[model samples]
Target: MFAASVAVLLGAWNNVVITRLPGYPQSYVPVNLAATGLLLAGARFAGTTWQELGLERRRARAGIGWGGVCAAVVAAGYAVALAVPAVRPLLADARLAGAGSGEIAHQALVRIPLGTVVWEEVAFRGVLLAALLRLLPPRTAVAVSAALFGIWHIRPTLSAARANTLADGGAGLFAVVLLGCAVTAAAGVLFAWLRLRSGSLLAPVLLHLATNSLGALAAAAAHRPG
Candidate 1:
């Protein structure tokens, strides 16, 4: 338990550092992958596997199904929100477009891409979640893991708002924090639940990877450059 907790904290700290580094978008992929790799490797070295972690196939299947449904729900909800004028604009920005509005171009750099998705799933959902499950009860572990995952986004949210913070520090930061927590907490629970039930981590990973890919595509298509 102690060791697993230590690993989780280390991963969280690594995210803190990685997300703050220059060229964050690129840096995050490798750093997050590496941390996840180390945790999984450590679990194997310690003789822990899914079976050891209490991941029965039956229960894991339930988790995966529920997780997939939740992921679908979130995606559908976001799609609906984007359809509405009031909130669609919040997530619109050309920076994400990366000079590629063409369908082929947008298809090129979708969030998780095919090649890297598997590796990331192996690392984050597979390794880290398993480690947490070993250290905590299945339900508790999933909840904590989800919360941690949500908090990981805090740095980027704040960094993106540096100017706003400079203009209105506490208010801007508080708003971002509140917003981040609410959204990521829901995402975290869904992802974690999926990971727990699937027992493969690939399910939630694919679910997330697809969300990033399709959501980005949808966002790009829905918003026009102003």
Candidate 2:
């Protein structure tokens, strides 16, 4: 199990770095899909069952009900955040500046859900967490998976830091990356908890969609044309 988990994490790291490389497929949707397939195949080979991996159909109703509530909360939060004068600037990420509606729609609807959300949810909250639960207590499993998930984002966070001036110098960039890791780690815990609580990936999947996709749309809306 340990070896399988390690291999999956390495594959994820590769995905993170490679997908961002020049000449890589745009949106990386196919990459994520392929990675997800391999990850699930590897997990099953390691003896993790669908139920253990949070794929229980019986849990779907609970997942959807709670997930909808959580998603609504997230949407309301984004709406509030976008409405605030001081917070509007934060929502208006400069990276999204001047993006056409089509581009933003692609990002929020297609790129985010398929490219970013699906694989991570499946890998972290599904396969990795399931594998860990077999070896550790529920809390420990969530923590380990969450920590690994956080580490997995380091390369992307570093890349993002380089794209913006928010991280001043080397030290500032380091701080930014560190903070990003911490924030994502915490998010990992939330996601894992949701997965465990509802016994279905649908719970975390819906919440993740709301958190990311809606946030992207909110950011685009908050952005004012100069």
Most accurate candidate by TM-score: 2
Give the TM-score of each candidate. Answer: 0.68, 0.91
* Candidate 1 lDDT by residue in tens digits, 95-136: 454446664353435335542454445544565666666667
Report the Cα lDDT for candidate 2.
0.82
Judge candidate 1 at residue 109 and give its lDDT.
56
Cα deviation of 111 in candidate 1 (Å)?
5.2
Stretches off by above 4 angstroms in model 2 are 2-17, 20-22, 25-27
Q: How much lDDT does each candidate structure score?
A: 0.60, 0.82
* Cα-lDDT of candidate 1: 0.60
Residue 195, model 2: lDDT of 91
TM-score of 2: 0.91
The 10-residue segment of model 1 with minimum total lDDT is 106-115
